[model samples]
Target: MNELYKVDTQDPVGEVWLLSDFQNMRTELCEGERCIYPNDLTKTLFHKDLPRFPLLVKYICANDWLSVQVHPDDELAKSLEGDPWGKNECWYFLQKGRIAAGITRQEKPLEDLRNGDLRILTPERGDLACLQAGTVHSLGPGSKVIEIQQASDMTYRIYDWGRGRELHLDKARVATKAAASAIVIEEMRKFDWKYFSIELTKKVEGSGIVITLSEVPELHVLIDDREEFSEEALLVRPGSFWSELL
Candidate 1:
């Protein structure tokens, strides 16, 4: 997702996979362009043949505004795209400002409701937004977001603010919710769906401990290039991920 449209140089890392849907993901193991696919883990977790990762996690840092868009709900997604799962995502704001969420209903055309019907919510650092399926949303400049969403990338554009992308008014009319579905997360931890969960780690011993509350059976820690954990130099960035140190 290294699009030329991305604005911030510090946030050039648009997307990466912690684990991925196997068809599109490859891992490097050797100097001779060795590639390994992550099909085994994803298959064992879901117990089915999947095209790609079931959950997609990424960081979205926008130096400028993004296109106003909406994702299809489960039923519509299945009927139209033949995909049983629709996208329901939540955003954890690292740097926050104005982000458009939800919609205001008017009896007019879909194009008219694009800008006028949206509401802006100001979320500071550590705030979360759980966006249900079919909620229309957009991100503005100076916003750094950590997004976790269902694997489907089916987006129906209402309007792009003149970005000139093709607008999907027909599908958007069926997909968007009439009442606003965007939620400003009121709780520190929310279990929205079975696909994933979001929780804030408490400050332990005056140190922030960020942990994932997953039902997965084991915590396989990798250290010193091995599949194990040991006391070593551990690094954490508040809003970003860096695998190496300079």
Candidate 2:
């Protein structure tokens, strides 16, 4: 059986004061921490239903900026952190205005961060980035995205602007140490369809990106080969709702 999970919305920096409103607009499935799926699907599937597909999809609407964060790699997470799996994510920009992504002060050395001179990279609309675990990144304000990733909720926040709250700097620093060794600060190459059965295309608009997904029915079981279906096309608009296939 197929199940859908909604993500739990959180405000780490308190910048997203209206998270409740934005949470209603977008949908997400953050496993272990804030999963909306009411079943033990995350645990049962990979074990009992080996042949069944276990993919989690989400529509993220960032009303306010998120903290600068990074996820741990599988080996490092498993060996050092004792996590069974790690995170690998891809982002499709739906609406983009004053957006920033990627690592900016990668080669700047730890001294830059100590001296408070670390620079961060921001992304624009029509940009697609594949986040390999351990990549330090964050999204700027006025951005919406369709995020597809491994079903794990192991995010390590590095920095959050001081907004009348204190962050867990000790834990965050530990996570940063594990991830700092692998941070890459370059333009991420677009996802290639040759690697996966699906293809995504994007067109630039005023402050948004019109995204299109192309797939061959033979390659995807959920997508029908007979006729064109609107449900098959997942469309995400900024400050709006997210659509998914059941």
Give the best candidate by TM-score.
1
Looking at model 2, report the run of 10 residues with the lowest lDDT sum. 237-246
Q: Candidate 2: where is the Cα deviation over 4 Å?
A: 1-54, 106-125, 163-198, 201-227, 231-246
* Candidate 2 backbone collisions, by pair: 7-28, 100-122, 100-123, 101-122, 101-123
lDDT of 2 by residue, 173-192 (tens): 44453333222223333343
- Alpha-carbon lDDT, every model: 0.58, 0.41
- Candidate 1, residues 49-108, lDDT tens digits: the string is 565536555556676667778888767888989885787787777655568887765566
Question: How many clashing residue pairs, candidate 1?
Answer: 2
Best by lDDT, which number?
1
- lDDT value, candidate 2, whole model: 0.41
Candidate 1's displacement at residue 198, Å, is 1.8
Q: Residue 14 in model 1: shift from native, Å?
A: 5.7
- TM-scores, each model vs. reference: 0.69, 0.51
